[model samples]
Target: MTTGRHAGSRAPGSCAQSAPLVLALLLAGCAVGPDYHTPPLSGTEAPQGWHATLPHHGSRMALAHWWEQFHDPVLTQLVEQADATSPTIAQAVGRVREARASVSTNRAALLPQLKGSGSATRQGGFGGSQFAGGAGGLSAGALNPTLGLGTITTLGAQADASWEIDLFGGKRRSLEGADARLTASEADWHDARVSLAAEVANTYLQQRECEALVDIGAATLSSRQETLQLTERKFRAGFVAPADFAQAQATVGDAVNALEGQRAQCAQGIDKLVALTGLDHDALNGLLSKASAQIPAPPDPGVPDVPAQVLSQRPDVSSAERAVAGASADALASYRSKVRQAVQEVEDALVRLDASERRVDAATMADAQYAKVLEASNARYRLGAGSLLQLEDVRRTALQASQSLAAVKLERAQAWVALYKAVGGGWRDDAPNPHPDHKTTAPTAQGRTHTGSAS
Candidate 1:
């Protein structure tokens, strides 16, 4: 009997040990869907080299600090401020947080769940003798503080645990998808920052260009007014015709009109800058006052010889790649289309940037030649060797050339900004791992705060 009793006890222990092993094997079962692999770039997807001209012999530039190349502290500050306060960035951060939470929820589903419960009850009543005796005795017992007979109390507690076996690894696949989405969300956040910084820089550049053009207009107006005064003196002395005097008067009127128009454009540019930087008018004006009105010259952002390297640096491309990885096999084709679009954007920006640089060179040469002609005409006129009409004609040509140069310069700057945005503004896939604590608030421009992921 003793041996049989020991054998029975060991059987229960053996079953208990085997139960955990069985659960672990179930958890390791094959997943239901296909595993993801990155598609290899080939043909049009990857090129040997860029078709567009590479700036600086295809040298690599640190994209993260691309704005610093301008050596403009105000540009850098404005970019930083825009990055901190952009609503688009805030939205991306929210998506990342949601994805992280989903990952946690899915991970927990793979583990055993437990539950505990408890209950208590109490009763009081008269004893058998008191009830059998009569109504009077029962009444007396009810009146008594301690009742006549039985009082009872009961307490109970219980615990339960359950686990839904992942059977075919559905839960694991869900976790995999969640992780991929989290990666995509992070990439999107970086993309937003890159776009916002480029926008702020471009707007600031436009504002400065507007100011420079205003200065040019002022100078041109002053020169035309002096010509008008000279023509008026000549007309009074009967040395010039009424036709000449009328032409001079009209030229001065045109100059005044042009100068006022330039001033209006400069004011409009300021409004755009204010919108982008989230700064009030006074504060924005104060910041603008600190810097001269010259457009900030952007440095060449070197392109990599390998087209694949450049494509990989783009955040939108990275995000698209992650989308492919997260999708079911049936949906992968759609996600790949996004990747192709991203590559196309980079190609387009490269072409524009290369063309803008060449245009700027040509415009610069034209402006210098026009200035020379205007200077010679002024000297001849002052010495009484050239007509006033000839001098005014030269001045008009010079002014047009100057305006063209400024416009081309602005176009070149905008092209650089587009390229910076297309290539992901120097953001890297290997940014430092997100903070472990997951701080939920970040400071914005002007002492304000908003809920967002830490930088």
Candidate 2:
């Protein structure tokens, strides 16, 4: 907070005599440790545009409160509940408070320290004995000897003040470090909240995806059961080979098995959500019973093409970057390496998202083609132009393709979730951006699209 004018300005007249000494001491009082500076990213890694692909265009994305973009009231409620209840978030908050207290402690060192003390003493002496020795012993004895053995009491109190002037600025450096650490703790809190929200979303999405798959399995099972019944009628009439009926029965069994697996997945998903939200099974089941199997698609947080811009939104990255500024050369390298790893994570998420999208496209195509082949096989079999084996084969292929497409869709949804997480979710321009060097364009004020852009 000191200005150059304040540090250099001299007192007038007689005071000028001590000005040089005062100035010398003040000049000597410089922060001893390395001053905090924002670490620079390699230009190539965070060029003008992010080297990664931009999903689509719109007004700039809002990173803060990003969970609200999902447009699912349940999701919003869940995230809020998690934030309020999560012990992890509570721990992070405690750390922030601790860091704030440390900053206050370090700052207090810059001022004079005052202490108060008091003491009391009591002494007794046989004054008569000494008087008798000095004067006539008989006369001193006649005078009350006990009277001379009086007790004396005394009390004293004092106050002290002392200060160690920050000659080498070590205290100042400590304060600076404390302030930086406080900032890092605050960023860590935000990072924790961001991570919590993402975790909740991912878990919730998984639950919903599990539900969708279960429904798919059940529907496929119902269709397979009907086919098996029809094949049984032909077998009973001796109009079809026993293998045809057995094949249909086996298909039904497989469907039953698949449905059981899907149900197990659903249960596991629910259990995970229960663990995360700390909700009882009955309450969670009731909450989800009202919800459809459709996945919750949050709005796309149109991640900037600039790597630095995206990195700025990540509180973890910001915390690490600040840490680097306060670290020694070796520690600085370690912190910087963490930042690099964070960037690499985002890159990996983007790659996975890309691959997931491709899988969805392929699965969609395969599902549609298989459906057509199954339909044609059914028609040909009904017309007595195709074997029941061909029909069953096509039916299984179509069902498998349908299930595969569902799985891919779920994977793509997860990838979208990961991408959102990797790109820093809702941490954005208008909020207290974690990155010290960030100054990106403001996010749009318009409401987000409910149908996730990834979908």
Candidate 3:
């Protein structure tokens, strides 16, 4: 019975010795985590029974050539130059490339970390030769085995690798995190693109709006001069009051100050354009001419049924989402980061929405106020109680008011787009029901459907 027990124990030891190798082979096909499926994209379904976000049947315009949407060749070329020359965009692009490479590296490390190494050395030591007293005479080792018997030079190269196999899904989860970050980079690139395009449009719009202001100011100045003349004549003929003359003089002074202020603003706009372009402001002016480039109104294909993708397609949305993810990852990286910070970021994104709404409200109110003043002044002037000076003031005020409203609307549009961007709201290239803007149609010019570039 003792002999049988010993044999049994020996057999179990033999099996245990082979277990690791068998297990290694068995585990070859497995990876960790529920294999990474890209997070589901939103906006696949039509909203409210009408085609979402695009009621207009327009086709996809290469947002890459977004400036072309304005039908401005000059704008296209200028934008191209800006893309090439702008350090900011270049930096952003570099970051994208870096992120892509890092992800590749992360994925590579997950496979197998292999390394080859070699070393060579030459040394001499006392040898234990069998010449003296039939003993290998090595004085170094004769006293003890501390010294090697002989010196050997070795050259070797080997390929070695080890992997934890991600049995717990830690590394695999890490890879998923990396992939999410990569998509985040792509989203950031898109955000830069959208932002650049919007800025260009804003500048162009501002330049035109400034020109409108200048025109109004000049008209007002002329009317002020006319009023001053008539008032002087009235004082000479003894039919007008001194108060009227003084008011006329004051109005003319105000108009002059206003015109000067506007000229400064127009100059400032030009300066901004200069900074945008690597070229000198004067050179750009020569090219662009202070004469307004006719702007094409944005196509109202229809109100876009905003996708439920409140976070997938919008840059800001994606950015904010990434921030949340990043914060979560950071929190994981170190327990020092409180969960409250992550929660706060989400709250911040929500607050941005409220801020945007408030801007729209403020703009609308300002515009309404200006409109009221403009109309009242014009009405009084037409009734002949108000002087031409007052009429010019009204006209200028009305122009500014209208422009303010347009600017506000532009801001609102931009804010909505930004909110959508911040929320990760957009159709991926592979999305089934793409936005109508993603559709294609022939480009139109200033309403004539001409395909001319801007000058």
Which number leads on TM-score?
1
Reference-based lDDT, each prediction? 0.73, 0.68, 0.52
Question: Which runs of model 3 end up more than 4 angstroms from their true locations?
Answer: 1-18, 25-32, 36-66, 73-78, 111-170, 293-296, 301-306, 309-311, 316-455
> Which model, 2 or 3, shows the larger lDDT?
2
What's the lDDT for residue 8 in model 2?
57
**Candidate 2 has which clashing residue pairs, if any?**
49-305, 50-305, 50-306, 63-426, 63-427, 64-426, 64-427
Clashes of 2: 7
lDDT of 3 at 26: 70
- Sort the predicted structures by lDDT, highest score first: 1, 2, 3
Q: Write the per-residue lDDT of candidate 3 for residues 1-455, one digit (tens) a residue.
A: 99999999899899999998788667754644344322232223212222222223323223234345556565655655665567676666666566656556766766977777765544455656432221322222232257645554444456777765655555655655665555455555555655665565567556656766677678767866876787788678886678777877888898899889988998898788777757687777775663463433333212223333222334544444444443364433232122223223323433443454466577668767876886687566545577655666665666566556555555444443333333332233432111122111111110101111110
In the range 71-122, model 1's lDDT, one tens digit per residue, is 9888888887776677787787788788778778977998999998776554
Candidate 2 residue-wise lDDT, 1-455, digit = tens: 35866655644544789888888688775647544566666754454554455566423666556667777777777777777778897787677677667767988999999998876655556754332232211221233355656555455677899987788877777766666666667667777877888899888887887887788788878877877777788789897899888888898899899899989988998888777788889988888887768776445546566677667766676666556554467756666676676677777776666677778789889989988898788778766688877777788788789878767776776777677677666443344322233221122122111110111
Clashes of each: 0, 7, 36
For each candidate, give its TM-score against the true structure: 0.81, 0.78, 0.59
The parts of candidate 2 lying over 4 Å away from their true place are: 1-34, 57-59, 120-154, 298-301, 354-362, 365-369, 379-385, 427-455
